[model samples]
Target: MENEKHHIVPYRVYAIVLLVLVVLTFLSIAITDIELGSYTVVGALLLASIKSSLVLTYFMHLKFDQPYIRIMVGFVLAVFIAVVIVTFFDYSFR
Candidate 1:
């Protein structure tokens, strides 16, 4: 078997990512105070997506992993978003 190349990410990058996630979390909470109606939920979901992306890329090592793995992850996320859209559409129509 061929040896796979390993990409070692720096600790500082992880630290920054963590900091960003924490800030996003706080922002998500803070946004709940204002009444944006439907946009509020959309904002929260957007923040959640950002947090998930950070976790997947840094914590899950997807950022340094192989291209195939990244591609698969992207595909899964796309499917998830599509499902969410369909569910929301169905509910809105009712």
Candidate 2:
């Protein structure tokens, strides 16, 4: 029973974080017409990234896992970001 208690605590924390992320996602969508300018998109994306990280780390069981997996995930994320930046620059320049 003691072992089960140790395992369940992290899950509870993950569930709370997931709930908060859902609330934030809904709130962000609801406030779309407020016109916060450039920051509006930035804020939404930042929140989304946080939500994704939480899901990946906890729900996906990456929190207490291997370093190689983290490195691969980080590399993929970096590549994705690079692609986005490149596309943005291309669109802006053209």
Best by TM-score: 1
TM-score of each: 0.90, 0.78
For residue 56, model 1's alpha carbon misses the true position, in angstroms, by 1.1
Clashing pairs in 2: none
Quote the lDDT for 5 in model 1.
Answer: 77
lDDT of 1: 0.93
Per-residue lDDT of candidate 2, residues 1-94 (tens digit): 4443233445678679879888978977865777888668767777778878888888877776668889999999999889977886897799
Model 1: residue 48 alpha-carbon error in angstroms: 0.6
Per-model CA lDDT versus the true structure: 0.93, 0.78
Task: Give the per-residue lDDT digits (tens) of candidate 1, residues 21-76.
Answer: 99999999999998999999999999999999999989998877889999898899
Query: What would the TM-score be for candidate 2 when compared with the true structure?
Result: 0.78
User: What overall lDDT, based on C-alpha atoms, would model 2 receive against the true structure?
Assistant: 0.78
C-alpha lDDT (0 to 100) for residue 52 of candidate 2: 84
